[model samples]
Target: MTDPLGQQRPIDIKAQLQACRSKEDTFKTLVMLSKTQPRLTAEEKTEDNKIKGCESAVWLIIEEKDGLRHFKADSDAKLMRGVLVAILSLVKGKSLADIQQMDLKAELAELNLSSYLTSSRTNGVLAILDKITSH
Candidate 1:
């Protein structure tokens, strides 16, 4: 299925992530982006609504507006937070079907992320996927 955010699948989420050049750069980018990106209200973010089984605290909020699934995510860990932004940028503004059909593992692998990620980090990615799929 085609991504709802135009024809581009953000097929380069990994490339874009790698282009950050440094983990600090990635974290800075995420923080800056999060500041500008639309966020879910506090009421929309509840403890029970957060992603479980993550080594770090992660919160995800999903909303289908105008037939598009929009995601907002945050994490306490700097690296995880950056990863969250990377993942969110790819899947955000997609249709439910598009999100469901996305092969995230393949995408990440193509981006060469798996080699750099730990088991916990890998699980964190899955947690992000779970949050997206849950909605």
Candidate 2:
């Protein structure tokens, strides 16, 4: 990704999440980020894009550019949108190999965010990762 200076840089997603002083702050930050994510069009919201395990109707759209994946995700549920953004933050603009190497569960655990999620939501998150890696 490019900075405001137009210089190449890696977005430290983990560090951004870690900067949140509390869970509430983290959640708010995520929600804000979610609003910034590109919305998936109706044509892109087919059953194929919908995550099967999610309680919420979450849709993920991925495009490859120069070997890096760009993700655009959305959900019917508001909190789920925030969760989607958090997950997307990790993998966005990363190569498939980088995303495949990620330990998403461990990262969430380290961030103390996993404990706040319901089992179904966790499953949904894993499902998203599974879809990404399978691509």
Candidate 3:
């Protein structure tokens, strides 16, 4: 993935979120970034894609091809969509073992993201990570 300046490097969501000046700015940036991979269509947001433990409805789909996982996710709430984008960024194209090795909750803390979310929403973050890793 390329940064906004078009530098060639892996996408680091922690660094991206850390660059934001405030919660409001972080959320706005998240929404803007999410446009890179927008919400799903009605047909794709089926029950098979629905996620549990999210306060707002979220759907995630993973497709494995040529040994890499490609993810598609969507959420009903804007904030949750942001969360999904962040989490998905971390796991996109990773192998199953790589996903298993990740500590996403700790990474979220490193990004100062937990400060912006309530306990339930934080759990939702965990749930999303869990779904991805477990896949």
Task: Tell me, by lDDT, which candidate is best.
Answer: 3
Per-residue lDDT of model 3, residues 1-135, tens digit only: 675644222356657788888888888867765665666899999988888887788899999988889888888787777767677767777888887888877766666576657878876777778888887
Of the two candidates 2 and 3, the one with more favorable lDDT, higher being better, is 3
Q: How do all the candidates rank in terms of TM-score, highest first?
A: 3, 2, 1
Model 2 CA lDDT for position 73 = 81
Total clashes in model 3, counting residue pairs 3 or more apart in sequence or in different chains = 0
lDDT ranking, high to low: 3, 2, 1
**What is the TM-score (0 to 1) of candidate 1?**
0.70
Residue pairs in clash, model 2 = none
Q: Higher-TM-score candidate among 2 and 3?
A: 3
Task: State in Å the error of residue 31, model 2.
Answer: 2.2
Stretches of candidate 1 above 4 Å error?
1-13, 18-45
Candidate 1 lDDT score relative to the true structure? 0.66
What does candidate 2's lDDT look like per residue over 24-96, in tens digits? Answer: 8778766765575567889989998899998889998889999999877889877778677667666778899
Worst 10 residues of 1 by lDDT: 1-10
**Model 3 misplaced regions, further than 4 Å:** 1-12
The deviation in Å at residue 87 for candidate 1 is 0.7
Please tell me which model should have the higher lDDT, number 1 or number 2.
2
TM-score of each: 0.70, 0.80, 0.85
Select the stronger candidate by lDDT from 1 and 3.
Answer: 3
